[model samples]
Structures are given as structure tokens and as C-alpha cells.
Target: MVVLGFMFISCYKGRLLPIEGKVKFNLIKSDTYTLLYMETEKGYPNFNLTIEFNLIQHGKTVKVELLGVYELHILLPAFGPARGIDSLMLTNGLNNLLFTYGSYTDYYAVQVDTCIHVIPIITKFTVYDSTLYGGLVRKPNIYLYPTSPCSVIVKLSPNGRLVKTIPDYDDGFKVYAYPDGSISGTPGYLFYEAEIRDVDLGTNGWCVSQPEIISFLQWLLPEYGFNPRECDDFIQYWGDKLTGSPYYEIYPITLEQIDLICP
Candidate 1:
């Protein structure tokens, strides 16, 4: 046997308006339809509203029978506060039913109308863990941590599936590898790494005496809009160049080997 339930919410605005009243329905042989109404108050001039409703049923299974059987129909008045009406219908078969309502506007409310049809059937069943058809199910553990360095240990289930992992803290930033072979760090550190690599002039040395490279980067800053902190290495390199200690070297970077750091 199958049982169904329905619910709805109505909303309005204003102080003196007639608040919407709850809806009522009748069940014949445990089956019937109901209509709920809400009217605007006298003082309230404008009406913005919402409505919500639910359906439930009880029996041996105690299912929320209205899973997809319920429908919400809203009716708005032409003048004053808008009015809303909701209806619920249930077919014969199942046990008990429950309904709930909620709304967004202060003037909003809900009405529940339940209709039950049909009688419930009774049966017996057996339960056993050892004789269960499917295998046991396990839940995975997820851990979130702040941006910093630390050891990450992940455990696997007996079936080689991810089971859980311990959360720990340490110094350094965490890097995420992408399917495209690129990597990204946290926000601040991401900008810093990009800036350092930019100033390194694709080399293993800093800009100690290259005024031209420093000037070029300064001009390019507008194009990248990178954070100032991210360019700290570049700035330091240029400062050393101004002091007559220019470290210029040519190095190459490829997307696949970006993780490698200079000595």
C-alpha cells in the first residue's frame, strides 16, 4: 500500500491586514483534498510572500510518502496583500501522515490538508548481520587545515579505498597538483612564488646589477597586478643591483619542472 501527504506556506506584508488562516481538508475512506487561504491585513499596503509545505505517511515503513506526489499551487490577489492557496491529495494505501510548513515573510504562513485513502498491510521479516547480502559500509574522514607545511598521512581501507587520515600541522605551504601538470599554492604564497620566478629572469641568480630587468618588471607590474609582497624577491634583487652587485644568469623553466627550486 502507498500513502501520500502535502503541505504549503503563504506570506504577505502589513500590520492591519487579515492574516491568512490555516487550511483544512476532509478524508473520505482516508482520502480527500484540502485548500488553504491567507488574506492581506488592512494596514499593510504591499505584499511580498512565500509558501512551503510537506507531506508524510506512517505504516510499517514510515516513509515520507509525499516524496514527489505533493504539489504547491500559489494564488496572488490583484490588490492589497497577495493571497496564497495550497492543496494536498493522498491516494489509498499506507499508514499515518505528517505535514510541516514555513515561510519567509512575516505576513506569510502555511496550511496543512491531509487526505488518506486505503488500508495498510502487515508482514513479518527477519534480520541478521552475518547473513546480510551486501558488504559492510564505512565512512571516510576528512580533515581541513590552515595554509602551512606538515606531514600528510592518509590511510586506506582493506579494499585499498581511502579510509581516513590524521590532521597535523607544520611549517611551509601546501601545494596542489593539477591534472595538467601545473601546481598552485595558497593565496599569499602563490603570488610570492610567481613574483620570485619572474624576477629570477629564468635563471638561478638574483638581479644584483641589472637595472634594465628591474625597470622592465616595474613596467610589467601593471599588466600582472600581482600583490606587492609577492615581488619582495624582485625588489631585493634590484636593490642589490643598484649597490653595484648585479647577479645575472640565464635559466629556463618548463611547466613540467616548475617544482624544482634553484640551489
Candidate 2:
């Protein structure tokens, strides 16, 4: 069984050798009511965004700081997020949400306190579909990091929903970027190595027919759009329940699937 969503297929080192893309970054959002705007008189640089998330109904901030983050995706998507959300970013503030991996579905999203968790991939080779030799190629064996040693295993429901999060203070990461626009870090896990091209996130919580995952999602890729969670978000949020959960290829599942997980 392909445990981590990676197939044991024979990958070929194609044309460009180490085909690469930079760790693109851009601001997603910020609050004007937060301290970020209140401390302007002290100069913009003096602004310290200590509050990661909004103060909730509990009347207390969650004290949230992403210890580590990751994602999964197909080797390439046929068509995916909103406007500039896809571009690389370098935040005006030290804090920002790092887009770990994105393509058609935007499979990855991490809520980090200090947006330093940038895992920029450095491709080692273009892994193409062996026998036929055309269509799409993946850049594997890429190296990424400057990580800290903290473990916070967060499992999401596919549409960027938080499924589970287990953190170990010693097993956390401190991710940062380098001068060349590449990122480097020592994650709670061995994150120094990463692939540049899109990779699989995995199939643990949702239902998906392995043979049809790509071709199926691809066929529906261009025209399918509905609700805040459709297609990839639906996939990521609910995840693949394997052969039994809910087959998207046969009939596309709806946002209603979210209710299925309710307590």
C-alpha cells in the first residue's frame, strides 16, 4: 500500500535536470484593528503582531503559533486559488502565512504565528512518467529548511480544516529563508529535503479511487466550482477515505460532506 501517497513507480530524470521554482510568498491578510495598526507612531517596523489569531469568545487569544506545517498534492494540476494568492511572498512583517504547496486545488495551508515557516523547494530532477515519456513531470529530491526542532503533527480535513494537532516542544521547527530566495529549516521532522513540483498530500481520512484520483479530478478541474469548499478544498478537508469512504471520481461530493464528520 502507498502509505504516504507516493507511488512506487519508476521515475525518470528528464530534461531540465533539477527543474526549480522559488519559494514564492505574498501577504494573505492582516487586521487593521490589531496592534499592527495601533503602533504606527513608533514607525511601521516597530509594529509587533503578537496576536496570531483573533481574540475569541473566550476573551483570550489562543496563543497560537504554528510549530510545523505541511501539505500534499498531485504531481501537477490541470488547472486553481484566487488572484495573487498564488504568487511567492516576502511579508512586510515577520509574520505571514506560508503557502507550502499550491496548484489546481491549493491543497496546503498553515496558520503560522511568525510567517517564517517557508519551505522553498530546490528540485533535484524532473521525474516524468517513465514508459511513454510525456505529459507531466515532477521535481523530486528537493531540499528545504532552516527549521526548528518542535513536533506539532496537525491533520486537516482537506479543505484546510484542522483534523488533529499533536505538538512536542522538542519536536518543533523554526523555518526561515535564505538570501537566494530559497528557504531552509530543520522541521520537527526531517524536512531538510523536499520536492519542487506538486506532490501527493496523502489518503488517510477521505475516500478516493487511486486510479481515478488524478484523471477524475482533472476532468472536473476546469469547470467545477461551488461553495467555499469544493474540489480540492473538499478533498483536503475530508481527505480520502480510501476505497470505501466517498468516491469523488464516480460522483463529485458536495460541501454537505462536512456534516458527515460532525459529533
Candidate 3:
């Protein structure tokens, strides 16, 4: 079974363990998912590490023991094959896992070995027609931020065909960015369109009244790292569209959710 990613933290009941320097995480790829095989370095024989987390399908706390160079078999599905389009809300029971020492009381955060590659962020948009229920996602403004000035390559492989893109999204968007987050010496993001029919608008979000939209966004946007100008722009763009319904149920799409959708 394909399992999603799990966030782990290292903890000790009394004294912190030097597991970071002693242990290593090796990614073993299987047909379905990538398994995290943790091994303690040589000379650290009989060194035991205990990990506790809830199982995905069953809500049971499973405690696994980690020995030196033994295959721990921690399946992290985040690095696995994409779940594809229809898998809208892929929830994981093992969102957070903790490594504990003796007595399983106090928790200490330990560093995990980095053994993974980074991928480009795919920014997608969908416009749902509540009355008709679904429609095309037109002109989605997608912004990309790089460390320094560079050319960005964007590949469009949506479930549906890419209708249109400004500046013509050929192979990629070749432009120089700055430290102040300006693209090609100008400001703004990418825009696009895709067929958004039969998409399920899940009921896992806030149901805010029309009058509460502004104040709600004022508090919400900042928490998600949105600047003042970006927040104002987002509010102006989406706030005007909420006039139809008295109460709008808005869901905040997370990065993990987006990765699962268009990975």
C-alpha cells in the first residue's frame, strides 16, 4: 500500500541520545513506495532507537525498535508514485511520528539525515461554478520564487489540457528574479487554465459569512506567509466573487495536498 510522508521528531526521556551522528537513513525503493531503512553506523552495536506512530489504515499506536544496521522498514509514500487526479484528499494517520527514549516521556528534536532531492513547485488553480457545480479554471496566476536571478522552466502536465498561458508557457519562463521577489524586474505571477469539471469541493473548510470575509482573510493570509500587498490583492480578487453565497465554505489547499494532486 502506498503511504504518505510522515514528520518525525527525535526525543529523549531523560538525556538526549547521539543518534544523529550514529544513525543513517537509506532510501530503499520498492514497486509501490520508498522504504526508509535506518541503520546505525558500525561500532554502535546494540544501539536501540524506539519510534512510535499511528498506522495509516488502523488507528493503533505501533512501537518499532531500531537496532544497528537493521532494516526499520519505514515506508514514506511521499516519494512514491503520484496518486493522480481523482485522489483529492489523501489523509494520512501518521502525520507526525516521534522517536522516544526510556520510559517514553520527554521528547527531544533530533536531526534527520537528508537523502532526498527537491522538485519544482507546481502551481495549479481551479475555478468551481457552485451553481452549475464545475467549470474551466481560467487564468490561474501562479508565482514562482527562486533564491537568486535565474530562468525557470515550467512543464504543464495537468489532468486536462492546458488551454492558455500568458507570455506563452512554451518550455518554461526564462526571466531574472531579484532578492526583493521581483520577476524580470517586474511584479506578478503566472496565469493559466485547465478543465475543472466533476471536481469534488470537499467539506473540510471554514464557512464564513459575506461580511466576515475581509477580517477572516486579514488574519488568515499573514499566517500563510502572504505579504500585505499579496494579501490585499488576493482578497480583492476572491472577495468580490463571494457575493453570490451568504456563507462561503473556503478550504485552504496545503502544499502536501497540491503535491498529491499534481505530483
- lDDT (CA) per prediction: 0.27, 0.24, 0.39
**Over 4 Å off in model 2, which ranges?**
1-57, 74-206, 214-263
Model 1's lDDT to the true fold? 0.27
- Write the candidate numbers in order of decreasing TM-score: 3, 1, 2
Worst 10 contiguous positions by lDDT, candidate 2: 37-46
Please provide, for model 1 over 1-263, each residue's C-alpha lDDT reduced to its tens digit, 9 standing for 90 to 100. Answer: 11010011122221322224432222222124422222223212222232223333332222211111111111112123332334334333443333222321111112223532323132111011111111111111122243554433322222111112222212322444333323343232222111111111233322222446566555543344433543454444333323222333323233223222111
RMSD of each predicted structure: 26.4, 24.0, 20.8
Clashing residue pairs in candidate 3 (N, C-alpha, C atoms within 3 angstroms): 10-108, 11-108, 140-192, 142-190
User: In angstroms, how far off is 176's CA in candidate 1?
Assistant: 16
| TM-scores for every predicted model | 0.19, 0.17, 0.44
Ranking by lDDT: 3, 1, 2
Top candidate by TM-score:
3
Of the two candidates 2 and 3, the one with more favorable TM-score, higher being better, is: 3
| Per-residue error (Å), model 2, residue 60 | 3.3
RMSD (Cα, Å) of candidate 1?
Answer: 26.4
TM-score of 2: 0.17
